[model samples]
Target: MFKVVICDDERIIREGLKQIIPWGDYHFNTIYTAKDGVEALSLIQQHQPELVITDIRMPRKNGVDLLNDIAHLDCNVIILSSYDDFEYMKAGIQHHVLDYLLKPVDHAQLKLF
Candidate 1:
């Protein structure tokens, strides 16, 4: 089964995602969470999940930094952000992020991704 990692600074958002995501529908079983990019990178190195869903504006190493650091890793990435700035989108695109979801992501849409 595939493994996934979810990273966000906000406890509520992170918990909500963990509870809401339809893990059964996807070919993944293991789901992990990290508070920030620092923790995320550590988790990535250890678990090497297939997918990573991360918030952009997190404390202690943002999503972009994590993405850059993990460029050599073989995995898909989805960015979650409250800001809809083109620059952030552009950065995600540059790193070949699988998708960029705005805050309050739709459950249906997230399942599809």
Candidate 2:
């Protein structure tokens, strides 16, 4: 089973994702959630999830910094952001992020991965 970690500053977003995703159908069993990048990092270290979906602009660490810190780890990353500009997208691409989703996340889009 694939393990997944989801991190976002907004409580609603985090809860929404947890409720919406049909994790078991996608071979994902363990799901972890956090409110900030710092907390996410701690969960990542402990869980070593196969995938990490995190918000780009979050308190304490941000998605980019967390990705950089875990660059050597064997985990795929999905970045979530309200910004759809080239700069953030470029950075995510450069870092080889698995995917990026804009705010007000689309369940269909997320399930594509």
Candidate 3:
């Protein structure tokens, strides 16, 4: 089963995702959630999850910075952003992020994994 780590500053978004995703159905067993990138990094180091889903504008080490810090690490990153901007998308692409999703995440799109 795949392990996944999810990070977002907003408690609601993080909680919503945890509640919404049917991880077992997607062959994922472990799901870790963090409120910020700093906390998320610790979990990432310990869990080394197969995938990471994070909000781009989080406080204290945003998603892009976290992605850069882990650029050499072997993990798939899926960035979630509220706005559609080239800067964020460009950075995500440069870091070889697996995918980017906008706010109010679409279940259909996520299921396509």
Candidate 4:
């Protein structure tokens, strides 16, 4: 079993994802949620989850910065953002992110990952 972390500034989004996703089905033993990149980074450093789903724009720290900080960690990333900016996409690519997902996420698309 693996662990996964979900990072977003919105409470509804964080909680909604936690409830909607079938973590057990995906072989995830634990799921952690963070309201911002600051908390997410701390969780990542401590727990070292196998997967991280993060938002691009966040308070305290942004996703791109978090990506840079966690580059040395052995974890896959899937960027989640409300913005469709190419710069953000480029950053994700540079960071070797597994995928870049948009806001109001599609459950089917997310499940495929």
- Indicate which candidate wins on TM-score: 4
TM-score per prediction, in order, is 0.95, 0.93, 0.94, 0.95
Q: In terms of TM-score, which candidate is stronger, 2 or 4?
A: 4
lDDT string, candidate 2, 1-113, tens digits: 89989899998988888889888888898889999989999999999999999998888998888888888899888888898978778878988888888987777788435
Candidate 1 per-residue lDDT over residues 1-113, each given as its tens digit: 88889999998888888888778678778889999999999999999999999999989999989999999999899999898989889989999998999998866767434
Model 3 CA deviation exceeding 4 Å by range: 111-113
Give the per-residue lDDT digits (tens) of candidate 4, residues 23-73.
888898899999999999999999999999999999999999999999999
RMSD, every candidate, angstroms: 1.1, 1.2, 1.2, 1.1
Candidate 1 segments exceeding 4 Å error: 111-113
Clash pairs, model 3 backbone: none
Candidate 3, 1-113: lDDT as tens digits: 89989899999888888888778888888889999999999999998989999999988999988998888888889998896889999999999888889988866667325
Identify the leading candidate in terms of lDDT.
4
Candidate 1: C-alpha RMSD to true structure equals: 1.1
Candidate 4: where is the Cα deviation over 4 Å?
A: 111-113
lDDT of 1 at 22: 79
